[model samples]
Target: MGMTLVRSLFLIIHQKMSTSSSAILTPVGVRGMNVLDRAKFLRNIKIPVLKVADEKLSKITPICKQYFLKLENFKPVQSVSGEKLKCIHMNPEKIGAWTDLSEIDRKSLKEHSVNEDNFIMKDIELSYENWSYGTIFKAVLPENEDIVSGFTQVGHIIHLNLKDHLLQYRPLIGQVLVNKIKSCRTVVNKSSTIDNTYRNFNMEVIAGEENFLVTVKENLCNFTFDFSKVYWNSRLGQEHERILNFLKPGDVLFDVFCGVGPFAIPAVKKKCKVYANDLNPDSFKWLNHNAKTNKLNMALFKSYNLDGKDFILTVFKEYITNYCLGKEKLEKGAKIHVTMNLPAIAVEFLKCYKGLIEDEELLEKFDCEIIVYVYCFAAGTDVLAVAKSMVIDNIGCDISDNIIDIFDVRNVSPKKEMIRVGFKLGKEVIFSAKDCVSEPPKKKLCVDN
Candidate 1:
């Protein structure tokens, strides 16, 4: 039986009595267990032998609970700075609406109408201000000459104007509509950088060629980020402060696809022990640079290509062996948090590690957390299947029930597509689930052995 073999191996190999060996009979999960005859024996075993689903099964039911919880906490908070979104104004006559004409005039126009109906959808050039007039019968401009275009499609609410020109020609109708627009609301926080009326969470963004200095006016928490020569995109800034709320003290954070230390620097700033890495040399340079800039202790950065299985195995062995050979034995094992920003590629490394590594005794050596960003391309050709293939090649054949939590699927583009799934490792020892894009799509359906 698989359980019998695992127990025997653990008893024979495990000698050191550190934090991992507190007592006897710790529940363990055996993934990809092919011994069907021994499955019953393994199940009946006193220890908790958790069974993980294969890649094929996981795809069929990809809605892992851990993936959802992380997203619930990661979404951007409402705009804190009371900065209003931009709007525009347009002339009333150019808007094209029909009104103010008498019944006689209307009858005359109806006689000459193309549809031979007394009523017509006309663009009478109404101003934005006219929208506030309840009794006023007005005609709005159609979309691209399409008469069916509704009021919402005609133009933005800001484009309305007043038609009267006898006096100073002020837009009375437009002014009314402008008042209807709600004033911008700001989320209050000390770390905000905004000043005076805009004093909510204002960040002074100092963009550089390879790095940027972000200083918060309120909290005085300044962070210099290295972007591997790539400026951090505006979207990241939008979500940074919000995501930073989840960091806790003393947590070991690992940013696997760490690009210029966006997650790592903030994590270290929160006093978390960080192990950040990136395949790109430029990225690692910035990662280390940012780590030094923040003066984060216990933060380690490694540069390696995560696409290959052998490279991953070597890295894990080195980190584990190094930890084991350290001055003190791992107290309760290293509390590691492996962050994978690359969704399409992280799974491969996870699968490889799951297949190659199985050290129940060394469970105290490391703990991992994975962040997977699943980006769906077009929707036409069975995107789920493609996603399934991608998931299998990336995450490996089987996974453990050690799912901490997963974030909600985020839309990366206009189309309701592309999602990011973050996986936190739970109570069991397992490799990272986040994956990279190394294995191309193949016709073969992944088989779980």
Candidate 2:
């Protein structure tokens, strides 16, 4: 009770919010109580509150404001002693007795016709019972364990990747999360790493509804998809915006792994023609549905359900072929942007462009530049160096001069990181790839209806 109330009041008075709470640990989980038990997280304590008349409440609060409880949604005024009065919170450290009161405090009390006679200690419930998911989780976690409060939210679902030590309390964590977050109706844990082709992992519903399909909005576009079937990182919302911001009204977007069109649909509304593809059929289905959901220009947005390698090869060939024959067209001041966002293996897919155009001679005829933004996970102190080396090794050509920018997109683990290596797709490297021998087989083009 003592520790709980003190820490709560201290953190509140200092205005330390949940942002700084994750790094902190609980020295006081509740005495003799099982930390795993949610019911054990209650504490009750009391502090002194100065009683002021209804008429003097507003006038007196500003003067002794420093001592107030400072809690959110706290109603300081109450019905007491058969009359309405305001209760100004106080503590031993600030003020206890009349003699210990500060000169200003003494003056405020005297002017308000209040004194030690009106000072009273009231009970305060200082417990995790009222704490948020962040606060409660931090309090229950073992001291020195890194908190796992960071989660990726997709619609009403909260996705958590718990560390090994945190697994023991997964149920508690999930239940608290589902209960605390109004929009969250489901909580799941990624049971394995995303090593599968679709970039989604096997997961277990730790709490709430078992439904996996949901709808969420991002970048002014509505996305509805099965969370268990596809890959969507909520943290990449800004990354999506960053890529979209770089395009002009008539620019072209080629999303090799479009996964429900996070990058594709928005570009369509931006008036940029989008050619998006995903190997996952579910992703392809939703990509088409989301385009309709946003009421976008279907003629401006085309989709395909092909393997990433095949998608890039067909799209690149068509893009260059149109430029050469004036079949399909790109307007002036509009660039061609290719996004390969599968961070784990997207670098390998860059080989799709090797010897891609047998003739980029049309490249010199156009005033535009073709930009490929390829993402990969690199583990090293210098992520950019690792990412560059990966791209060079796979493409069989040094593209140092072609690099537009190499961004440390986000951290995937303690050491591994997701990096976006963007560069100009010029002719020098497009002619050949020594390491890449796997070519796309001759077949009918796979287009999504």
* Candidate closest to the true structure, highest TM-score: 2
Provide the clashing-pair count of each candidate structure. 44, 0
Write the residue-wise lDDT of candidate 1 on 1-449 in tens digits: 11232233224122321222111111123211222122221211111111122322233122112212111112211121444311111122221122333345435434433112211221222222323221111111111221110011001111111112211212222232233333211111112111221111222111111112232211123334321132232233433443445556755555555666667777677766665656555555556666576666643334453433444456644555455446323324335555554443344455544423455554565444333333323233444544545554555543324333333334333433333333443323242333443443221111110
- Scored against the true structure, residue 124 in model 1 reaches a CA lDDT of 22
Q: Scored by CA lDDT, what does every candidate get?
A: 0.34, 0.73
The reply for model 2, stretches above 4 Å from the true place, is 1-39, 63-66, 70-77, 90-115, 125-128, 359-367, 432-449
lDDT of 2 by residue, 218-332 (tens): 8888899999988777778889999999988999999988999989999999999999998888899888999998999888988999988777667767777777677877786
lDDT of 1: 0.34
Q: Identify the candidate with maximal lDDT.
A: 2
**Each model's TM-score?**
0.40, 0.83
